[model samples]
Target: MNRRSLIKAAGKAGAGALAVTALGGAMARAASTEPRAASAKPRIHVGSDPGIGRWSHAKSTSHEAGWTDQFQGMCTDGTYWYAVSNEGDNQRLHKLTLDFSSTVASLSAPRGSDHIGAPTFDPQRRQIYVPIEGPEPELIWKVSTGLSTVGIVPLAGRTPGSPAPQRWKCPWIALNPSDGLVYSSVFGDPERNDLDKYVDRVWAYDRDTGLLKKEIRLPSKVYAVQGGTFGNGGRNLYLASDYEEAGNERKHVYAYDFSAARDGSAVRSWGKVAIPDADDEVECVVFAHLTWRNARDTHITVGILDDGVFSGSTDNVYFRHLAVPSPGLI
Candidate 1:
């Protein structure tokens, strides 16, 4: 199966059953199987302002699939969103550079079609870490400028009934410059059990030990998980989906405020970032978003995901400017 099929399968499956508890696909099962330990702490606030305000999708003369969390990708400057797509017919990381308008650029991954599911940039090293799914031989490729292959790591096995590597693939990646650690989310196969859920957990990989240091579970499993810095040398990880929480029918952004989760640690439900209302419904949908930052601060450009005059699904990539409060506004 391909990425599109994986998403469609998720919608037809436990998606309905999750309406009661508000979780879907592999993530829902992971949440129920491993309940969160009580967070004695108060609800932490990760940002002074949090909301996507009025961003309509922007049609890039060059790219499509704007501002979506569906891919294992991150925004570069908080000014533009980019992704590595191995989706059917589409291959390569879709790059958009947004200024007054958006322009698309293509950077082919070192490997073939094994869809690029996760990507995080190490600005210091000028390197990009991307996870692969469904390639002839499964592996994750570390590509740098000139798209050099700096390192190659074999990923864990896929889940059974996992929808053929596309419908329900696992995404694992986390890099915080300040923490000096990488966190990866891993899952079991999708076909082995009748139950739809999977074992989803985050692990800290120490560069030296080569052994995962800490294993921490989340309040729930998040299919489109991405982590980055929020300006203060603190790590801000956000998970999104129109349907990704248990006991809550509404879509939500699970913000893990790990300003303090260094030294092999974990953070919890710090806050929620709301998904903007789409005129149409989206499913099993994995999307890549663009980013821009004045400096250390990072946020998506407005309307990069909104459908426009483009019509039909073609509207997936477009951006319209909206009034959003920022620290500058504060």
Candidate 2:
């Protein structure tokens, strides 16, 4: 089926529900074992925190003109922005203007991988770290700013004592400049009763070698994390969750203190901002300093893929530029 018909069919079934259905099988098999009770309750609460400041929407731009496949993750290098789209045999990585007004260039997904997830940019190495989901033993591809594949890091079979041999499914990745490590985790379902069992910790990899460095356990689990990036000058890690509970009209972007996690201290959410879109699927989040035309400022941008399947609209994608009092200026 073509894009339009596929979207129409998906719409009738419900876009969010369709995504869960399409991705659910892999997630279930990826779980090492059945959910069991935790030894102790997490220190942090499951819901939003009041201390976190709210992000106000500043502006948005559509990608309808230069439409790719379903938008996945996005990041920036203080100047241009980079994004990825996954369409199973036709995935792509896109370079865009700071405002996301137009696509500057595009590259086909590296050979051997079809589904590309959230991506992070490394300024020192000048490469974009992209998460690849399928064809088993998920991998992370390092592509240069010029859009050429530089290196490939296989994630599976690296961690010791991991129950399953092929469980690493990279849905998103983020780079921490301070420690020079890239972070990623297996996707989880927020609505599942045993959500904590699946997404209890995040794996950090050596930035250059892609070797398994360490696993940082969270004080609380954040389910269905579609995207992640380091914000506040690499002091905090921000995550975006796409799963919206039944009858709930909002999803959330969560924040965690990176320094505290490194110190092995009790880390809780600094705050969360609710994205009020019920129809569109939230894909990824990135913090960057952007300057376009006469406007110059910083933003905590979230990528919202138009689920024409749910919204009954054309295939489109856009980024919502959100503002906070202080964004740590990238």
Best by TM-score: 2
Residue lDDT tens for model 2, 167-242: 5456677777667778777666543344222466777776555567766777676666677877543556777777
lDDT of each: 0.37, 0.58
TM-score of each: 0.56, 0.74
Where model 1 places Cα greater than 4 Å from the true spot, the runs are 1-4, 7-74, 77-81, 100-105, 110-113, 135-138, 155-169, 186-200, 206-211, 220-232, 244-249, 262-266, 278-315, 318-330
Error of 1 at 314 (Å): 5.4
Mark the 10 consecutive residues where model 2 has the least summed lDDT: 20-29
Clashes of each: 42, 1
- Using lDDT as the measure, the top candidate is 2
Reference-based TM-score, model 2: 0.74
Model 2: residue 300 alpha-carbon error in angstroms = 0.5
